[model samples]
Target: MYSTRSSKILFFHITIISLFSFSIVKPIQAEPYGMAGCGLGSMVPVWKNDIGQVLAATTNVSFSSQTFGITSGTSNCTNDGIVKQKMAQEVFIAYNEGPLELETTKGSGERIRAMASLLGCPTHANELGKLMKEKHSYLFAKSNLENEFRSKEILVRLKSQIALDDSLKYICKN
Candidate 1:
């Protein structure tokens, strides 16, 4: 039993309230990959090991040539000393050798860049390349050694969890 003017006023008030509420109700984003798997204490070494592997793979060099720790006991870099040393080796290779490999090199891991190039995803490969070329930080997800090289299946799951390109195009291809 409200008048037309009152009805219009009520509608305007409700619309304003709804817009305000929507503005405040933002979607919760998943934490970045760098923050997910590792802690501050473990960040430096893990990042280094990861960058090293990428560099070695890019240059077609054996992981052993770089003197990374590989204990017969476990597949993990359990010791802090080993982890730090491995990361240092990675830093050296990334800074010193990455450009040389790109200029005149043929390595198995170069296939990653080749495939990306074919897909016209050279930008993606370049970003990955820059990660090796630059310094490490907590925000640097690509340099996260363990997670970056995980099996494709696991990577898909992880990416989906973070809502990062949740498409299954790469997974279901026979």
Candidate 2:
């Protein structure tokens, strides 16, 4: 019973409504909860748009500090290590919120991981040990502690972010 022009108008209205709904509904929130459950770094640049600017700036600072260290010797490493640590701290400050921030305040695993990744992935276990000993005290009390802080941070953040209760738990196997 509908005319051709009426059918075209109905199609146009439906298209406009769907597009508007999409613009506001935020599809990224539906990303696998496993991704956002751990840390803001895994979520922000992926789920949200505004945080990329902060990430970009932090990346630049990390690269500059890392490059500066490479140009010098041990002194360069020391300076870069210090800068890298600070840069990681700043990134944590910029990205962290809610319960994740609370867990990091206790100790900073995500920050340490960010710093470790910035430091070009150490080759030897001893070297990694040395860096943790010399650099990332905020992350661990000892060089042996890499995942402790982040595990707790992620658990708490995930609990709240995903609205899970005593019935659920999220632990990273890796």
Candidate 3:
């Protein structure tokens, strides 16, 4: 048997954890599977914790509170986990396709870093930032080719980083 005082204390502890968990739960691994076979986005940890959403639509007037989703039919929306997987896959394809250079000296590099950061790969982001810092002259028409080479190099590097970084594995498994 628990006394009223102890019950209150336990309840308070749980309340604190629940409130704080929302801020960080997004970093937790998303659906083990990418969005493909998953039941819905509502089931994704990122969807529920990082974003507040409504799990289902209702015709009858009723108020309900839920974590993550704000819309009813958004269950199939791509979540962070899926985004990471897609990013990895895109890089993989680019690495092989040989249009290969990314324009790391421009906005494209920044976008890559941003994607890495969102995917929980700060190390990769820093490495990408460094690559963009390198200066090189671009020829009028040949400049495009050089830029593509640099970008491709960066994506391949990111592909390797995902292989080594533990945090990155959650999003880019295999």
Candidate 4:
């Protein structure tokens, strides 16, 4: 028989392990899938239900087709989508930080035009440039300047400002 102290210690260990496991659990994604996501297993019509997740998982593990699909952009896997678009926007902003700053301050530039295109507002580039010019200080606040994710912060602020503007909100796709 275990001592009372040993029992308490075991309970504590189990509690901590359970908490850690919950913390590491991924949130459900937008796309519907069983335990196995976007692969040959997911494509199998008979095993589409929640209860069939075990079979799907087994199939995915057995074939390793998910890895191939993600890499090759096949089997319902996407190479370009919302996530990639956001990353591309962040990267573009980071690379053109100096140019964008100058263009925004002046309310126009080729870089600003390119940014508008990236944002899915190519036709409204002039309006976007004007908005950016107006919110230049807000978009590049000193606090934001010191951030590690400055580009992302800038994009957020820019989108926020566009949303606030009646004219831009309807025109900008993003």
Candidate 5:
């Protein structure tokens, strides 16, 4: 039979071990829409916190122009490049709204193609889509999306990747 002292010692050891183990385990969190889609990447040249502020001002001004155009019964949306850009925005929005993984699967095909089209790379869309698929993890999943530092790290890495490729380099500027 175990003595009371031994039992208490065992209980203490188990408690200590449990606490130590729990402290080391971290949950795998899903990254936010920013990293999952190129939301954060787009802000590049601009950091994370400022991206929203800048976007807010730009959106307001852009909306004012759009509204004026609408009231005047003119929409540049019908223009060739503008039409493709609208399609690209739809894809980008869909990526931000949908599950993170969906960005990898569906996006690698249509979304990338849309982006390429918007960037005037229609002929190279398929190739770009294939490359985006191949690089999805580094481009999306590798970072803890909630951490701006980590997001920026991956974004820089992604930027370098884009910079290195002629077909994808132009997006780095935008």
Candidate 6:
């Protein structure tokens, strides 16, 4: 029973609120699945548009493919959570290279603590920092490499060192 003008205003308000809600939502990290979410549907090339998302969602729900994929680790799903954790660590190291380097050299800092937490040993941050301090030269030896490559190298060396140490090997998850 609404008039045309009121109906138009109501539609406008709804549209604006929907847009505002979407704007406040943070993007998913690492996973690039669009509006359709992760599944066989997300792998489809057409999922970039709204209509494509509807189709992709339909395909997902109709087949129950997303649930199957998630349960069985197929269709862009991974059962190995370690891979995501490692990726997060890599990103953290790459972004905080300078602070990490300084902390590693000094054998303690907020960055070192954060890194220890990322490596799954929050309580042993000091010990991890000390280890880094001991291996400062070895860990930072690849400084001549590009930034991305250098961070990767540092990660490899750090993990290797951690693996060698009895205490760290038992405690560290990564």
By lDDT, who's the top model here? 6
**Root mean square deviation (Cα) for candidate 4:** 18.5
Clashing pairs in 6: none
Model 2: per-residue lDDT, tens digit, 71-149? 2322113333433443443333334433333444444444334433333342222333333333333432233323545
TM-score of each: 0.18, 0.20, 0.26, 0.51, 0.35, 0.54
Question: How do the residues 1-174 of candidate 5 rate in per-residue lDDT, one tens digit apiece?
Answer: 999999999999999999999999999753332321222232233423556546633542444433222222243223334324433333333333234335455446554554555445666666656665677776665544544354345445544666778766764343
RMSD score of candidate 2 (Å)? 18.1
**Candidate 3 residue runs with Cα over 4 Å from true position:** 1-75, 80-103, 106-110, 122-126, 132-154, 161-174
Provide the lDDT at 115 for model 5. 51
Off by over 4 Å in 1: 31-174
Estimate every model's Cα lDDT from 0 to 1: 0.36, 0.39, 0.42, 0.77, 0.48, 0.80
Can you write out model 3's per-residue Cα lDDT over 1-174, one digit (the tens) per residue? Answer: 999999999999999999998877766454443323223433445434322233322211122211111112133434445434444444333332322135444424544454555345545665543433332122111324454464445445555655564545565433
- Clashes (candidate 3): 15
For model 1, state the Cα shift of residue 70 in Å: 29
The number of the candidate with the highest TM-score is 6
Name the runs in model 4 displaced over 4 angstroms: 1-83, 144-148
RMSD of every candidate to native, in Å, equals 20.7, 18.1, 15.1, 18.5, 20.1, 12.8
Worst 10 residues of 5 by lDDT: 33-42
In model 3, which range of ten residues has the least summed lDDT?
Answer: 59-68
- Which stretch of 10 consecutive residues in model 1 shows the poorest summed lDDT? 66-75
- Pairs with backbone N, CA or C atoms under 3 Å apart (clashes), candidate 5: none
Per-residue accuracy of model 1 over 61-107 as CA lDDT, tens digit each: 33332222222213232335534433333333343333423422322
Q: Rank the candidates by TM-score, best first.
A: 6, 4, 5, 3, 2, 1
